[model samples]
Target: MSTELLAVRPDRSLTDGEAALLLELLPPERRERLLWQAEQREPLCAYGLLLLALRRRLGWRSLPPVARGPAGKPFFPDFPEVHWNLSHTAGAVLAGVSDRPLGVDIERFRPVTPRLLRRLGADSAEEALGRWVRLEALAKQSGTGVIAVLNRGLTAAEEASAHDLTVFPGCAAAVVLGEGEAPGQVRIWTLEALLEGLAENF
Candidate 1:
């Protein structure tokens, strides 16, 4: 399989193979849930399809039925060995998978209002905003969600210090578990390019 830096996009639709792979990973009940969501169209497509693509890409053997914790974090029963995290806002969703535990987040490149920034800010310093977001993303990936990080800010300082940060100037934002090494670089996949590649492959 070509591991040439997977760059899935917000607008690219899933191929039949991709969709089948997603269904294969989902448990029966979750399959129903995904099917129900798929019936709605548009936004769910970006979230669901990308999720399935990532799940397949990571070679998840099987997933437990969707189960939630008291804190409402989602979990899989069968594949606890694989760390998985999901985040989506406005136009896109991100799924990060890693062996060493990982978290990912994506945010559109828009101005963060000063007031909102102060309220969401993890620290008083401006430089810490990315750190805060990274921490939040990491927490989400860890199944603790932002509340855990927001509540206990100093914990997981080592993982939070993962400095492989990059900015994507497009319709969405994404963060994923890093291999402790910042990717030498990232490649962007436009919606058209992705569709063309799929077509050519077929």
Candidate 2:
């Protein structure tokens, strides 16, 4: 199964007007769900990144209808074979799609203090940050929220399935794919490029 990833820097996140245009492309239900967070830029920008990746990798002309899993994770019902997940942090936003199920997470790359390590229940600074993103990806892959996986350790199989990502300069990211599947490098897009994509005929 091929897995594709895309990441955007927070510096390049969309403006309200650009987000509104992407928002119009969503199905009514999804659009309604986002209206409440109209002031929140990350989700809108992250979702727009998802659509951009879908169009590029899957050759999708128009977005397929979206459905939510029990945990409120969105999926393409008509494209059940297609799996995807989105994530964002203070540093960057990411989108991933694959033929098999996948989950992704990105976190700002900041120094972790001993206190922070204690809070994360990890041994070292790097371990703390690494585990943080791992648990997030696993939770997302399982359709379980991040809270459910917080403080959780990776099993042997999980360790093998997860891959570290180096997309944005100030971010640490991770992605979980089908057990034993390899996650390749990401496709980085500038905000201007994504905006250009939005201007394309759908």
Candidate 3:
């Protein structure tokens, strides 16, 4: 099964009208979750935009109903053949789509606390963040969340199976695919391209 990963850096130049247009396309649940803060809103909108793009790519007639897994991971309930996961941080949002199970995580750079480092069992801040995203991505891949995996930790075999994705500077991202599945090419989407795609598809 092929996997496609898309990343977008939130555009600060979007006009109020354009923002409304995008917001209108989001489901009521997603639209209501929009934050008053621009920083928060950008990544959320990016997630919605990515969902629209993925739907079009898969030739879905409309946005499918999303259901939460037992561990809080989201999935398309009616589209069992399509698997996807989304993650967003301060300045970037990431989405991964595949024919089989997959998960993706992105985290912006920040100094790690000594307490957090110890909790993550990492020697340094960078290592802690890397390990954090990997563990989180792995949890997502299994339809579980980080809290669950942190409690149990990954098995040795699970540790050996994840793929670390190349991301822009100042951030870390990782993608985890089902065992034996290879990740396909990474795609970086421009804000214009995403907006254009939405206009065409919607």
Candidate 4:
């Protein structure tokens, strides 16, 4: 299965004009959800922008309807064959798309407490964050969520399926793919490039 990762850093809050442009790409039902907290607007807008990019990359004339799985995982009901996951941190947002089931998670880096490090079973802050994201991605891929998976830990199968992703600096990220799916090159796009692609396609 072909898989791709996209990451964006929106350094500033989205302007009214830009928010309107991005909101046009979202389904009507999702519009109200975009009215998030002031701090969340940028990442939320970035997530919407990523969906637009994914739609164009998949050659879909229009964005597909999204549905949630039993575990609250969002997916395309019309495009069952397409698998995807999204994550957002303080200054960035990430999206992963594949032909098979996949999950991704990103977290902004912060100093890890000794207790937290031991809980996650890692030696350093980076290692701790990486391990945390891996577990979260694994849970997301299985549609079980991190709390469920963390309580039990990764099975041997899950251990082999997880892959670490190098996202923006000061952030930790990872992706988990279905068996037999390998990760492809990650494509990082600037906000201007994303806007340009959106303008050209939609």
Which candidate number has the best TM-score? 4
Q: Which clashing pairs does model 1 show? A: 104-175, 105-175, 106-173, 106-174, 107-173
How well is each residue in 1-202 modelled by candidate 3, as lDDT tens digits?
A: 4777888877566777667767777656556666455554455556655676577676653456667878788777787788888888876888888888878888987899998999999898888888889988999989776888898988887877677777678888888887877666668877777777776766
Q: How many clashes (backbone N, Cα, C below 3 Å) per candidate?
A: 5, 0, 0, 0
Q: Which stretches of candidate 1 lie over 4 Å from their true place?
A: 1-7, 12-28, 31-64, 111-113, 120-132, 164-167, 170-202
Deviation of model 4 at 190, angstroms: 0.4
Poorest 10 consecutive residues of model 1 by lDDT? Answer: 1-10
lDDT of model 3, residue 175: 86
Quote the lDDT for 9 in model 3: 78
Better of 1 and 4 by lDDT: 4
Which candidate, 2 or 3, would have the higher TM-score against the true structure?
3
User: What TM-score number comes out for model 1?
Assistant: 0.58
By summed lDDT, the worst window of 10 consecutive residues in model 2 runs over 37-46
Model 3 CA deviation exceeding 4 Å by range: 35-40
Q: Which candidate model has the greater lDDT, 1 or 2?
A: 2
Tell me each candidate's TM-score. 0.58, 0.86, 0.87, 0.90
Q: Give the per-residue Cα lDDT of candidate 2 at 145.
A: 79
